[model samples]
Target: MSREAAAPGLGHNGGPPLEDPDPDAGYRAYVWRRAHRKAWKTPPPEIALRRLARAEELGMSYKAYTLEILERGRYL
Candidate 1:
């Protein structure tokens, strides 16, 4: 089935919550998802390649290091 054909929250736990939209942030998010998907598609950047290299030297994969930095909110 197509992604759009699927429910937004189907298979998420029992299913989508039966609640009404917030009417404020909900519509904003809908528009943002459609208009800005490409803008947010890629990873932030590789300006931190030097840091990534260090992580690699220390036996960490780039993916792991990137996630760690982002999780720590230190995207340096």
Candidate 2:
């Protein structure tokens, strides 16, 4: 059997094919990823240390605590 037939879900490079084949969709995804990453920029060191300590005390991860703050604009 040929390589394509051997791998049912894989593309030419043996990876999953793009779910959305439109070039504009790819560009929009890239932009959304960049903006999402930018939204998670590191806070000032003092604030970051405080948040980390609070997160630990609350038995939560730094990311989870921060995401909560970003979504609700409040501390837990």
Candidate 3:
């Protein structure tokens, strides 16, 4: 075969072509979600109250603080 024909995926795109966007994408997503649930735990109400207080002290709303924790696993 010609070089171009042999090199079906070689181009500016810069990687092997996707035969499937995801072969086991569903399984992978399921595993990731399971792990995430295992890693994240809800804090007790008192801890939540302290976090709210700290958020107020930092001039941030409680909602913003909780969202930050959910996104990053900690408040910045």
Clash count, predicted structure 3: 0
Q: Which ranges in model 1 have alpha carbons more than 4 Å from their true place? A: 1-18, 24-46
TM-score of each: 0.38, 0.52, 0.48
* Candidate 3 Cα outliers beyond 4 Å, as residue runs: 1-18, 32-42, 70-75
In candidate 1, what are the lDDT values of residues 1-76, reduced to their tens digit? 9987665665577655789767699788888788566433455457456766778787888767766765686744
Number of the top lDDT candidate: 2
lDDT of each: 0.68, 0.87, 0.78
**Candidate number with greatest TM-score:** 2
Candidate structures ordered by TM-score, highest first = 2, 3, 1
Worst 10 residues of 3 by lDDT: 7-16
Model 1 Cα displacement at 36 (Å)?
Answer: 9.7
For each candidate, how many residue pairs have backbone atoms clashing (under 3 Å)?
0, 0, 0
Off by over 4 Å in 2: 1-24
Instruction: List the pairs of residues colliding in candidate 3.
Output: none
Error of 2 at 29 (Å): 0.8
Candidate 3, residues 1-76, lDDT tens digits: the string is 7987766564456665667487799999999999777645567899879988999998998778877877887667
